[model samples]
Every structure is written in C-alpha cells, then in structure tokens.
Target: MDMTTQHITLGAINMEAENPVELAAFWGTVTSAVPSVGGGTVYLPPAGPGGFAMFFRPMAGPRLERQAAHLDLTVPWGSRQAEVDRLLSLGATYKWDVLDEVPHVQWTTLADPEGNLFCVAEHPPAS
Candidate 1:
C-alpha cells in the first residue's frame, strides 16, 4: 500500500444559503465558475487553467457562527485594499483585516454572502 495511492480525489465546499441559486450566482460571478450540476447541491465548474472546481452543499447553520476553516486568497502587492472594496460592493462583508506585523504583510480576511470566509488575493502568474 502506498500513501499516494490511498488518496482519493474529491473537492467541495459547504454553504448555508436560503437560496442556492442566488448563492451559486454570487460565487459564479466571483470565481467565474459555472454550475456544472444542480438540484440537491450546486457545482461550480472549473475556471481558467490551474483553477479547480467548486461545489456548494446546503448546511443547517446560522450566518454568524465563527468558522474554523476558510479559503484564503492572496492578491498582488497593493491590490488587497482595492479588491476588498470590490468584494464589499459585490455582496461581501468586511469581517476584519489581518496582517503579520512581524513578517511585514500576509492577507486580508473577508466573508461571502453565506458568511463563508474566502480571500481575494493577487492572481499568481502561471508557472
């Protein structure tokens, strides 16, 4: 048995949305991921090269509970503030800004419409 061989390929995102369509739309616009499947759960198709697929699952939870896990997005230098503002305009709420005072800088924290945290970072150049 090999460690690499035991790993299964699966990717998804859990969401608590009153309306899945609207929630999917919001994510779609932000990530440019289309809905690959619909009905019980909505799947957002993959984006450009190097991008991965996303799925939305209904969760029975409130919008204010703190999340132990979240998505971190990193924007290019000097782009965090602007991108944060843009996300705010597009149905996102500003939770708090985080920075590593010791290491200079790191990332900003933001949450989506469903209160799910995701970061808007500088798009890394394709290697």
Candidate 2:
C-alpha cells in the first residue's frame, strides 16, 4: 500500500446529546453547515475540507462526566470577542476569559448547552 494512501483522515466527531435535534441545530448554526438526519442520527456537514462533520447521537441521560476533548474555533482577527458574544447569546454558557494570556493570545472558554467545553480564539486573517 502507498504510505500516503495509508494515512488517516478524520471524518467526523461524534457527540452524545440529550437531544440530537437541538444539539445539531446549534452546531449547524455556528458552522453554517447543512443539517441532515437519517437512521436516528443527526449530522452537520463539514464547512470545508479542513473542517470535520459533526454527528450528534441521542443519549439516554444527561452528560455525567466532563468532556475529555473539546472543540476550538478560531475567528478572523478582531472578530473573536464578537463571535464569543454571539455564541453566548445562542445558548452557550460562559466559563471564563483569558486575555493576553500570552503575547497576542486571547480566548474565552465556554460550554455548550450540554456542558461540553469549547474555546473561541482569535487568529490573524489569512493573507
């Protein structure tokens, strides 16, 4: 087998949610992804090649443990704060903010409706 062909590529990140519809809607709105449902699963298609599709599975109960992994979203320069605010208004709960944690680094940590932690960071616009 060719070494390049054997390399793995991420397809999607499956998340457990008490309500797949709501969770899928949230992610769909954030990413502007097209949402689809079938076989009792909800999916949000990837925004681009670098992005991965999100799959939401219905869970029997509320999330009982902290998430060991989380999503990090980066916005264009000068848009991080506004994006955070918009997410908050869209049902994300604020966790904490770190400003100037390191030179030119600023971010805010937040949890989704299901208490899954994710971060929003600012990055320089693509040249």
Candidate 3:
C-alpha cells in the first residue's frame, strides 16, 4: 500500500442518550445541524465543511458515570459570555468557568439536558 494513498477522516461522534431524539434536538439546535432518524438512531449531519456528523443512540440505562470525553466549542474573542448565556437559555446548565493567567485563556463548562459536559471558549482568530 502506498503511504500517501491512505487517508483517515473522522465521520461522526457517537453518543448514548436516554432519549436519542431529544438529545439530537438539543445538539441540532446548538450546531445548526438538521436531525434525521434511520436504523433506530438519530443522526445530525455536519453543518459545514470540516465538521463531523453526530449520531445519538438510545441508551440501555441511565448514565453510570462521567463521559470519557467532551467537546470544546470555540467562539470569536469577546463572544464567549454571550454564547454561554445563549446555551443556558437552550437548557444547558452552567458548570464552571476557567481562566488561565499564563495563557490568557477563558472557558466556561456546561452540561446538556442529559448532563453531557461541553465547553465554550473565546480565543483569537487564526492569523
């Protein structure tokens, strides 16, 4: 096999939710993705280029523990607070905020209705 011929790209991130449809609705609103159902799963296609789709599956039982990973959403500098507030209005619970002096970074943690954690951060745009 030619090394250059091999390419791997992320297609989607799968999550288990007590109610897949509801969870998909929350995510769909957040990411501006349209949700569809097929094969007993709720699927949210990527909203734009370089974005990965999301698949929400029905959970067999209540969440047993903290999720192993979470997502970090970036916003243009000075917009983090407004975005966080918007998410709160959308049913996301505020967790906490973190500010790093050395790197001058700031982020706020929040949980979706199902308690899946994610973050919103403000950072300088690419030069």
Candidate 4:
C-alpha cells in the first residue's frame, strides 16, 4: 500500500516597509544572503547553505511607529564575537549590547538601515 503523506513547507517571512528593496538589501547584508525581487517585493533566502528565508512586504506609506515584531538571529556557539565584528563591517549599525545571565556571553543588537532588529551570536557551530 502506498501511504506516503504529502507535506507543505514555510517559504519566508514578509516584512512591511516603505522601501522593500532597501530593506531587503539591509537584511541581505545583515544575513549575508542575496535578496530576490518578485511580485514587487524583496525576498531573502535561508542563511548559509540552506536555511529559513524571509520576505519584505511593501507598505502603502511610511511607518507610524516601530514594528511590534522583530527578529533575533542566534549564531553558532563560541562565534558571537567574530560574528559581531563581521556584521559591523558589513554595515550593520550597533543598536545595543547584549549582556546575559547564567554562564553569560556577549551579544550585539543591530538594526538594518530600515530599523529592523536582528541579533547575531554563536550558539551552535556550523556542521
């Protein structure tokens, strides 16, 4: 008997911004993944060889306030410092510094030019 079940998958995240291209590019730079343009929107594929992808949705006008939702990127363990330096070099402006409790380590809060928050830290090494 053929009982193979089909499955659906999540493609990406859609962000609302005045300038999709610019915003997308910022995320692309932050994540080091090229952004793809389609349907008048910018899309970021999964990070590294293969990962989760994100998309940008164009808002009709400027944002009235900060986005209620945000992104947090967890880098591989023991690589937070290095990742921080690399992202800074890539044009990710520093928004804040992370100080954790309980066997703590350093983390940096950064933002794209469009003001989207994303974090970089080394939690688990690349395989």
Candidate that would win on TM-score? 3
Residue range with the least summed lDDT across 10 consecutive positions in model 1: 97-106
Quick one: how many clashes does candidate 3 have?
0
> Tens digit of lDDT per residue, candidate 4, span 1-127?
9889978676787788888888888778776789989988888998765467888888877675766766667776777778778877777788887666424445678877676777764444335
Q: What is the TM-score of each predicted model, taking all chains together?
A: 0.73, 0.84, 0.87, 0.71
Task: Write the candidate numbers in order of decreasing TM-score.
Answer: 3, 2, 1, 4
Higher-TM-score candidate of 1 and 3: 3
Q: Write the residue-wise lDDT of candidate 1 on 1-102 in tens digits.
A: 555756554455656676777788888887777875467678787677656567776666665556777776666777888878888888988877656533
- Tens-digit lDDT string for candidate 2 (1-127): 5566575888888998888888889888888888798876898989887777999988967676667788988887798889998999889999998886675667899998878899998865445
- Model 2 C-alpha RMSD vs. true structure (Å) is 2.7
Of candidates 3 and 2, the better by TM-score: 3
Residue 12 CA displacement from its true place in model 3, Å: 0.6
Candidate 1: where is the Cα deviation over 4 Å?
Answer: 3-10, 60-64, 100-104, 121-127
Candidates 1 and 4, the one with greater TM-score: 1
Task: Give the backbone clash total of model 1.
Answer: 6
Q: How many clashing residue pairs appear in each of the predictions shown?
A: 6, 0, 0, 9
- The root-mean-square deviation over C-alpha atoms between each candidate and the true structure, in angstroms, is 3.9, 2.7, 2.1, 4.3
